[model samples]
Target: MDSSIPSISPWRLSVAPMMDWTDRHCRYFHRLLTQHTLLYTEMVTTGALRHGSVERHLRFNAEEHPVALQLGGSDAADLAFAAKLGEQWGYNEINLNCGCPSDRVQRGAFGACLMNEPPLVADGVKAMVDVVSVPVTVKHRIGIDQIESYDFVRDFVGTVKDAGCSVFIVHARNAWLQGLSPKENREIPPLRYELAYQLKKDFPSLTIAINGGITRNDQIAEHLNEVDGVMIGREAYYNPWLLTTWDAQFFNSAESSITREAVEEAMVTYMERAFKEDGCPWYAIARHMLGLYHGQRGGRLWRQVWSNHKLKPMQPREVMAVARVALAKGAEVPA
Candidate 1:
């Protein structure tokens, strides 16, 4: 990890850009846990920006500074136009999504399908770089389908690097787009982290961040010793409490652990502000926080109580009251 890489920032920990799961609300919650971590928006298609509401797709809390917006598309012009929009809207970075393997993404002619066409990806990155002053990065898999060669990824990186992309986030697993569901695609694809480490060795100038199935703090620490950064996905979402320790453990920042009560209280304030200013429903934001108490004493009961009562036609603060009671009782919560 060269300190001189123009796009590489001081933050070495990042949240992966999950499609439906890493939305603005989720990013807000994750930001509450760690101050120095880089957060990412969910994958927003180029079509969404061109044909849909740019404001709706790109809106995020200012607290999520150094946030990267991941764009999903194959066309260079469309991607460039969308990247410009993201820059104008105040995103710190614009990341091209080249790793997703869902059938819908493939049908749209992007995602892992672009992995087989590095030239097109280069062109897309070049277009984005030409338009936006912000750094344009790429997230991709080692390979796609049955093509598991190391040269495949090396060439992919080489091609994109030639187009001025210095940052690469490798998921460390190939995408079996044909037979596997997206959930299965995440698990079934065997991780080849050694290949990612080799990539760092091969392109020492490029800032490489490895992602996929990374859960524990020790694993994050170990990978950081090799790669420039580490991106955590589902584990960060399902077991968010793990992030409470990130500032101290990863960033070497001051310890910022808050009790579950404080977290819920913060969420209560957030919900009130959202409802008053943005017309955000309680459930819309609370859905992401259901896992906040995960692995703690009385977690399940808190979830059950909130799940049953929050959906009713009531104020958001009222639902917080329910969660407060559940937490006080010390009900069993799953890890």
Candidate 2:
């Protein structure tokens, strides 16, 4: 092991960063569930950092440590500066986004499109690596469009690795760059986990983490056997309780004793404090936690009370009380 490397792999288990999700509040909520699992910010474009408010984009709760900042851009200079900002703002790692196939990203000449230009991606990675001491990683698909040749992705990893990126978070699926909406791209692409495994085998010195269609803990365990880590995507957001078991199962820590109710209470306290300090509304925070009781009895009713627009004017504690009452009774919202 390198002297710089930690005793435990920081990439061991993580939540994949998703746009429109995985914001500061979401990361904070996840922190309450598992202390050790790595969290990532949604893809922050270099242009945004160059022209936008830095605080609004980089601000995060201190508890979200071991959290990574994922940047979406191809310009080496912009990436280097954005990565420096991320490190200065306390992000634990800097990740390059190479697997997103959205049209917007394409227009910006990055994301999954970057896969077509390995040298360019390498430049960006090396630029960031030179500026930040934190580990630089890349999250990308196995292939792009109809090109399924293993060599396409193989060469990509080889080139980027040379540029000082040692960790690769493989999405385990081809990114259909055309004709597929982002949602469709996520599901329609066939997952070939073997490609990710092969990347680990071919580059044994590198840390390879697998992602895509990995929802169950057993699946995470199975992948971990083949790779260095496992990253859960939308599943972690929709079924957050799944995170409650990660520490005990993956990190060999004690089992979590917190229950669904307790987590909700904690969120209520956080919501009040957030509003008091930042004027952020409870509903804004509440939206991220609506899935806290997912698959539990009366969960829909609980979500209903919390998501109800009429409750916007009420205090978060009051809303939590109403939600708990509705959850226990399993009845419709009061008129």
Candidate 3:
């Protein structure tokens, strides 16, 4: 697990597929920071793909290569059809969501609820694997509600692996099904990383990637020693600068030459192109990069300038000038 040598596994590190957060614009911005870390789209429901606009759900910048599409559904036929659509749209992998505990997903009879129905999860995984050439994976919690016994999850993995799913992303917390908002579900449950390590121990042949309560680079390295990879969620989004060092730190690549300013300029160019090509507004993309200077001296003022709706009429380049001015002004203030 020493990171001095580059990892051979594609799932060695990843950004979690958070709903409404890891959209195409966000993925495009993230791609600027770390090229090797696998990215994923928000959980696109099977019903959305079947009845909604395919382009709106599947379109992504070519730069977001190595990205995966995460699907939320329990039906075998729907999953297979959705997986085919994702593959056809140039996604590198197809992931099934069995980890989300939102009531919306519960109403659809999927997500964390599917853990109690392992055969259904297995059927969906097999159905997708049968149709897609790309790897089919699942993201799930260690246990649901009061089901803390390790056997519950171990058997779930055993059944799904038999259906040709070789990778599992384990969120090492129980998805408390009742009386908790999704945000609370992420925080209220006690993180049990050891359970994820045990999963790796039991299913040595399958790639097991752990998620939950992992933020620092040291924590990521420690988990990699026990599991194949780590999937970062909120931390990765709010403090994306953490990704700038990942290639050299985890992938063993040369340090990234990009500076915060250079990344900002690159995003500006991307914004202009997006607007001309698809009538997409620049703010849609700029919002994702507000954390580009996170933890730096001028981050707040810089973010304030970018988030200001009054600047909507200005072109992206002009807004960049204004933001840089604010950033410099903020830097003059003492800590």
Return the candidate ranking by TM-score, descending. Answer: 3, 2, 1
Give TM per candidate: 0.95, 0.96, 0.97
Question: What are the runs in model 3 whose C-alpha is more than 4 Å off?
Answer: 1-7
Q: Write the per-residue lDDT of candidate 2 for residues 96-117, one digit (tens) a residue.
A: 9999999999999999989999
Per-residue error at 104 for model 1, in Å? Answer: 0.4
Answer with 1 or 3, whichever has the higher TM-score.
3
lDDT of 3 by residue, 111-136 (tens): 99999999999999999999999999
Error of 2 at 72 (Å): 0.6
Q: How would you encode candidate 1's per-residue C-alpha lDDT over 1-335 as one tens digit per residue?
A: 56685453443789899877898888888888888889999999999999999899998899888799999999999999999999999999999999999999999999988999999999999999999998999999999998889999999999999999999999999998899999999999899999899999999999999999899999999998899999999889889888889889877679985876787778878988998988887777887888988977888778876677535697777777877777768753433
